[model samples]
Target: MAKIEMKNPIAELDGDEMTRVLWAVIKEKLLEPFVDLKTEYYDLGLKSRDDSDDKITYAAAEAIKRLHVGVKCATITSNEARVKEYNLKQLTRSPNGIIREELDGTVFRAPIFVNNIQCCVTSWKKPIVLGRHAYGDVYKNCEIKVPGAGKAELVFTAEDGTEIRKTIQMMKGPGILQGIHNMDKSIESFARCCFNYALDQKISVWLGTKDTISKTYDGNFKTIFQKIFDEEFKAKFDAAGIEYFYTLIDDCVARIMKHEGGILWACKNYDGDVMSDMIASACGSLAMMTSVLVSPDGNFEYEASHGTVQKHYYRYLKGEKTSTNPVATIFAWTGALAKRGELDGTPELVDFAKKLEKATLDVIEEGTMTGDLARLANPPAKQVLDSWAFIDAIAAKLK
Candidate 1:
């Protein structure tokens, strides 16, 4: 078959660990074989970030903005242990966080359902999409260690030299003080993204926040979402036969447990981070979900919701084969390709992407999968394969 032609290039950001190993194999086996691959590649591995002082990360984000689409491999967010392991100069910030902030995007995650793997939550019959605010809050925070009893104050100074101050705490002992903030413009962007995505997916939107406690902070979010919905999206939502509502974060958790899925639960940064993982695990393995960051201005960044398989990577280094799931990563590629095709008006490329996704899920539904999914397979997986073997199985089907 003649390789599918591409009208545009995608920004491909590579990363670390077991997923990084699988990234090359996936491209070689599944993508390059069928499509005339065109990409602006950037290495986002920890070492590269350390070498460039994370300039590579900023460049990758810029590429996505220029190209309007990107596909990323799972990356490492170095802690003290990882800092030592990689022998890094400094503990760099999360690449994903930086990218999200740079792009000013909102992450939407949903489970990839297959008949063989049953949802752990029996009540969840459909997919619950998680719309995560991708900017501000704790992702960008400043902190200080309080070595002794002292007073901590929150102060703000204007450009004109006007100042406002509030006492945050009167520390009676050694403790920690942290300050996190969100911009009104970013919040407005987040609100519009959720509403627009819900309209696109034809699903209801549920926003969860703690307005009762963090009145000024969380209340601002509630107020903005309502204002945007009423001012811009209410008529459209009514026409689409969907609804939008807000509830306390705690109440939202309870509601998620009992409600039959199919709603877009828009959450604050931290809430979405925690809840998306819960949703992913409840549906199946973390590798069974798809994540895409959609900016208000129409840029798209596709990536797996899960992190790099660090333990599995360690085992692989010791010459031990590990059965790691690659479904989410595969979907990340497919999602980017499909979106690229859609934007470029290349239907053949879009069709190829669809076929590739079908091939992946079909293999899983046929009882041949990696250990993570094999354990959850309802009729019991007939054959459990290692990482490479699993991709080979899907490649065979793709061919």
Candidate 2:
């Protein structure tokens, strides 16, 4: 049978191990049956990444920029252990780091609900989407240790030779100094991405920052989000029946823990760092979460939230069956493909994407899943399917 014409082309990034195997099966069983997909394929496997000196990662990011959609598999993030295992130079940053920098997009994580895993927040009937600024704060702070402190000053030098410096006194004999910053332009981009995502999803947007404490720094985020909302998104939001709300970080976090999840909460860099972990633990498996990068200009890239199941894949290579959850990785493909279809006005491709999501969720609801979620299973139900078993089931359901 001739493959159906895909609505638009999407960049495909293949990764390592069990997920890498699952990636091919998903394509063969689900995507190939329905669409004549044009994918700009890039190998992001650890071996290939090392072989190409990691140029393939940069090329993949560039391809996604050009094509505007990319579906990535779970890839190994290099650590000291990984470095020894792969025999590489000092542990290089993750391939995701390279792509994240190149694309300059915001990472938003949303949970997949299954009947088996218990959520921390019982009221979360809908998804609590987190849009993390991801630019500065602790992730890029400049720190120095004071042998014997005198004074610490944060100095900002303007391009026209103007300077503004604030001196913070050290009360103790030995102290630590930290100077952190966030550019107005970066925060502006973050605001735009969050606001756009909220509007696009037809969901409410909430800005949370330490505005009361970091009056100047966090308040800038507050001001910018408010200004942008009023100037840009307010009218559109009102028309769509969504509200843009701003709350102090302390209040927001406390409230979010109790509230039913539906709003798109935008956090500063540090808040995002902490909250993502909290949300991940709450929602169940990190393997079940899907991440997407939404740029200020509305460019989208999707990927699994977890790293390559390297350890598990290695066992599988030795002829041992492994049960690596492929749901998040699968969603990455459907998410990118669906968005590409939506962007290109291909309703059929979009429909297929939505249905594919339903099919995967249906399998889980039917009680068949991989190790990550299976462990979380209330009673390790009778319908549990191994990795390949689950994949075949989803494909059959899709048909």
Candidate 3:
């Protein structure tokens, strides 16, 4: 079969650990054979990032912006241990964080539901797509550990030399204080991205926040999302037979647990960070979760929600076979390819992407999967394959 030619290049950000090893094999066995892969590749490995002073990550983000599509492998975000282990110049920031900030995007995470895999929440029959507003709030907060008694005040200074101050706490003893903020522009952008993504995916949108308590802070998010939905998306959502619902975060959680989910749950940054992981665990292993960062302008960067398989990589390095799941990584590629194909008007490429995804899922459904998924499989997989063997199984299915 002649390979399906790509009309545009994908900005491919490579990474570290076992996923990186699977990345090479996946390309050779799955993508390269069936598609004329055109990619502007950047090695985002820890060593490479250190060698280049992390400029490579910035360049990769720039390329994704220019090209409008990216598929990323899981990379190491440096910590004290990692810095010492890798012998790095300094502890670097998360590559994902850098790219997300550069793109100013919302992260959407959805699980890959297989027929044989049992969901922990037995009530959840459909996939729940979670859209996390990836900017501001507690993530960019000013925190202070107050020693002894001190007055904690919230102060705001305007450009015109006006000052507004309010005492938050009159501490009699040592306490902690934090000042968190979100930009209106960023919130508006996040709202639009969620609405646009829901519209594109033909799913209902659910916005949740602690608006009842944090009337000004969380209320702003609710208000912005509501305004955007009413002004921009109401007509389209109605036409598509979908609805946008809003409720308190606690209520939303209760409702989501009871109801069968096919809804896009748009969450505040902190809520999203916690809830996405919960949803991923309930649905299946983190390896089965797929994530995409979608900008307001529709640029996308796809990646697995799970981290690099560091333990698996170490075992493999010691010449031991390891069973690391690659489902999410494979889906990441399909997502990038499908979007690229759609943008470039190549239906064949889009179809190829779909088929590749089907192939991966079909392998899982057929009771051939890595150790993690096998453990979760219904009746359990009697025979579990190592990482490479599983990829080969998917390849055979594709053929």
Q: What is the C-alpha lDDT of each candidate?
A: 0.96, 0.81, 0.91
Comparing 2 with 3 on TM-score, the higher-scoring candidate is 3
Q: After superposition, how far is residue 95 of candidate 2 from its true place, in Å?
A: 3.3
Residue 98, model 2: Cα distance from true site in angstroms: 3.5
* RMSD vs true structure, all candidates: 0.7, 3.1, 1.9
Assess every candidate by TM-score.
0.99, 0.86, 0.94
Index of the highest-lDDT prediction: 1
**Candidate 3 clashes between residue pairs 3 or more apart in a chain or in different chains:** none
TM-score winner: 1
lDDT of 1 by residue, 56-126 (tens): 99999999999999999999999999889999999999999999999999999999999999999999999
* Residue 378, model 1: Cα distance from true site in angstroms: 1.0
Q: Candidate 2, TM-score vs. the true structure? A: 0.86
lDDT of 3 at 380: 77
lDDT (10s digit) by residue, model 3, range 238-291 = 999999999999999999998788999999888987899899989889888889
lDDT of 1: 0.96
